[model samples]
Target: MLKFNHLFNTLVLLFPIFTYASFNVGFKQINLDKVGSRPLNIAVWYPAKNSGETIAISDNTVFYGSRVIPNGKPLLSNNKYPLIVFSHGYGGSWRNLSWLAYELTGQGYIVVAPNHPGTTILNRDIKQSVQLWQRPRDLSRTIDAISIDEDLASYIDMNKISAIGYSLGGWTVIALAGGRFNTALFKQDCMTHSNLKACELVSDLGLDNPELNNSMKDPRIKAFITLDSGLARGFTPQSLKNMDIPSLVIGAGIDVGDMAVELESGYLQQFLTKSLSTYIVIPDAMHFSFMQVCKVGAVDLLNKESEGEGIICQDGGTRERTEIHRELSYLITGFLSKIFLNTAD
Candidate 1:
């Protein structure tokens, strides 16, 4: 029994516990009306002081992830923190990336994530999907709202803003970072690589309208981080070459095997000739693994609820979800700090 106890103690020592300051989370729901009557629903998360309550979250009755209760006041910290605008994947809700939001806020960042109205699961308008140009507009609008809003402006450092996106959101950030969309190129690639699932989806959505194009780049965004970017083939080499911002591309290793990583995230890193680009591949991650950690029995429920989309319920083999979040938080926070906060090793 003593020998067993010794072994347990040694293991515990090897896996040292990591902890952070218990800062209360302050949350607010803002309506960005600058973009006309159809105000964008912006979910803001920031550091606060006080207790919070647990609340339920959902995506148009499809999948239900974990609930979060933010505890704190509306007051901003004395220090001016960098702002991170997060764009969610297609048919994904703002709450989908709440886990990452929570982590960033806890580490001294004001994180604002908005749900792209028509593209979110709550709406899912195919016409909205086709007009992919609107995606980046949604993000710019969110940034504008935060800037003018008296409450949000005080907490954020306007000059040190960065953007992070996943899946379709990844494409949005790339566009915001100066990568222009090319529908003709996308079509040609699809014709050549018809077997790619992303191509098949694009063909179904028919996002080939040239009239919807616009200048999506925002000068305020100094850095961009993308994860498992989708439909990246739409950006031509010339458009990407124009990008001068520091960008990071993270992809799921499993996505490479699935044939989804090559066209978007992979393509961006390979073709961005002028930008400072860094790429990292999480060896065992899948496209959906970047979302919130699944709730109890979420896999079974998702399989029973939706077809083909149940892959969202799965994660990399033998890897705990919390561990993935921890690693991501560490890398992301470190990267942002180095560039925006001017904190160097």
Candidate 2:
């Protein structure tokens, strides 16, 4: 616990919020059935009149893997924060994404995130695996939970809320922003693969279940961001072409020989209806840009397998990846400040 305290103090000094109070709620029990309706043991990091309580900050693999940064942790909290909801990739924990969460919170946004059931730390548990299919519904529900639940209703300004997600979390944000997140599309993408990794990593997600996809209805979210979130299950110009809301898409391009991804952010900038949409491509990034240290450290974990397939991944350093994360933070904060904070929609 002292470790977290030291980590927290180091972070507090670096990110003194000049805007709003920052409070963090961590490692709370999550109700898989709840989304917008629940207070997800989240950390609200803004400029607050330091409450008398000294809660412990956790040490996860996020900041250079069990290697704490000096007087740092990007996921640290700040002051006078705006509200932001951060969704993590599949098969991770709330702590796994703490780096991004703390970063946003410290920068003055109330960041809320939930452990998508089957996609959590206990991922191998078969019964929990079912939660993967419940993602969109879960994202929507989490929004509802905070919006309607009396506990956090007074704290969050719904109009100021924005969402940042990566990978599957990327897909989930799209659905919340009114894009089609379907299972059939996932299946279609998986047809050529004949392996378990294909099923577990790509297809089995409930993102495709129509009953779930068609049921999502959220208006509180002001903007959407997808990192490495590929094509939506149902992407038609009609559906997203004229989405006037500010949309940012970040993706990657891979070199078949180098195992390096040419990072790119691809939103149809020309589609006037999707007027505010912007895209960027990160050079040499892989599919795991937006994850905790485990994924980043183990990046070679998959790359090792790539060698057998005649592919050699040029493992860029953590410094490079950290730079990418910084870029992400800057982009998101800037976008939200412009659209949700500085300018009125």
Candidate 3:
């Protein structure tokens, strides 16, 4: 018994207990009529002063929701927190990145994610989804609304703002960073790569319109990160070369169907000549791995609802989705700390 206790004590000493800061998540809807866009449903996560009733966010039969305090009082602090605006993949809602938002808030940062109308799961409008330009505008407008928000504005440091996106959202942040889209180039590529999922939707996506070429850059975002972005071929090399900001480009090493890292994420990093960008490929991850974690019987239920929908829960290698998320958290938090907190390992 004495020896066993000594061994247990040694093990405990080796792996010290870690504590996380308390945080709360709040939801709001902001109108974008002035910008000629639809209203946005947003989720804001930040440090909290007191714990409230803990509830599961985005809980459903398929995906497991994140547990967080809702509508709790904000933490009182003199120091301003860095702001991170997150954009989800096509057809995803703010709930898609709820886990990451919670992680960031616990680390003393403010995180906000907006459900882009038409493209979000809650509201899918074919007309709005085709207007890809409006996607980036959604994020820009989100920042505008938050900057003046009574509850959160005072706690955020405007100058320390950053953007993080997944899938199509990745393309959105790149556009915000001054990457211009070339509709003609995209159409030409689609014609040859019709097998690609993005190309398969070219007809419906309307890539030939000249309006897509317009710059949608938002200067407020100082740093950005992309996770397995799509439509990267639409951005011209010259435009990517002109993106002068700190960027972290992450890609899923495993290709699931039409999305390929070399053609999308790698392509972005290859042409980003002017930005101080870091590139990383998560070997065991797939395109859908970046989404919310799935429940035990999620795959069966998803496929039962719609054939092939179960792929959303699939990953490349043997590692579980939770394990992938841990690596992602480490990489992302380390990058943010290096840029904002000046505490890079």
Candidate 4:
């Protein structure tokens, strides 16, 4: 009998220790030599009881003493823990939002965060990256290799899995949840819709892109969720025909960039076969609010490409925003619990 406190108390716990089990746990890289050109990087945060686990916590402490803070790990995989892959926004890497990774780990789930090829600041030239629409392909491939051959199988419960992506990662998750993305599907309209005409029509959106083959048909992923990842490219009614899994689509009140559209979530609802898919829009928050990269004082989340891009001044009014994130996490954890625990009631 799970009481209401088990759910509501998540937001208010005085001596809350998010422990080291959810701390910085990094896995080895995957080589895609046979399937692709170069090997890819995937940042992992495994779930474990935050109490006492003799595991290595990453301390790549580089950025502004931020990474210096140590040990508050993911929840325990005492039995078989479910896997949840997290996708980052455009131009960001796995190290950027370790906070989200750690928090999710505390909630009794294994989290996988992968750094998309060209989008990372490590190689700023987005044009050359194979991981654009290939992000989902990358996810599907990595997932296959991990489940089939990697040591990850010992730790991960591949049968019970979901995905949560932010911004560009949101779009990637959308594609993975069964939205179709084809490049030729929009090649004619893309030429006019995009301003960088001669600059090579690069779509952060993944619809109709040739990169999306049967890669999204991964059987292990049971559920899907996306945050601030409304489809940027176009999608047809038939494009989303394969979306049958339970889903959650989360968006922020304010659009930090021209990244997410207002009605895409609603659009997806129309196409989904399952009635369980839910949509949530957190009020008074921005896109970067979901990511650990942006902060109130020292850090700013507004992208230069955005009209909504501006410094979110924090003069002690950020508590509301924090509350919102905590609320969102609670909702996500609950939704995931329903799926992994098989508690439809």
Best by TM-score: 3
Q: Write the per-residue lDDT of candidate 4 for residues 1-345, one digit (tens) a residue.
A: 111233344442432323223433433444555355545677666643334434333333222112311233333345666788877777777765566566676655667676777777685554445446577776776676667644557766777878887767776777776776655645654565453221132544333446654435555568888776644444556756567788877766565444333544545556656476776665556666665433333323343445434443221235554575576666777677767777221
- Top lDDT prediction, candidate number: 3
CA lDDT of 95 in candidate 1?
A: 80
Q: What is the lDDT of residue 183 in candidate 3?
A: 84
Structure candidate 3, residue pairs in collision: none
lDDT (tens digit, per residue) of candidate 1 on 1-345 = 011134433443344222234455677778777477345899988777666675654433444444444434654556676789999987887887888887787777888888886678787777566667778888898999888777668767888889999888998888887788777888898888777666867633456778435568899899999978887877888888778877877777675344566555678877775337766677667788788777677676777877655678687667977676666666676667667645321
lDDT of each: 0.73, 0.51, 0.80, 0.58
Task: Output the lDDT of residue 189, model 3.
Answer: 82
lDDT of 1 at 222: 90
- Greater-TM-score candidate between 2 and 3: 3
Candidate 2 lDDT over residue span 1-345, tens digit each: 011133433443354233333333322223534354322343333323333343434453323432122222223332223567767766656565566766665545656677666666555454444444356556666666666644445556666767777766776776677664456644764464323132444434543445644635367677888776643433433556645567777664433332122211233233315347756555545565565444344434555555442121232334555665675666555556657545452
What TM-score, over all chains together, does every model reach? 0.85, 0.67, 0.89, 0.71
- Model 1: runs farther than 4 Å from truth? 1-22, 34-37, 51-71, 203-206, 256-259, 273-275, 343-345
- Poorest 10 consecutive residues by lDDT, candidate 3: 1-10
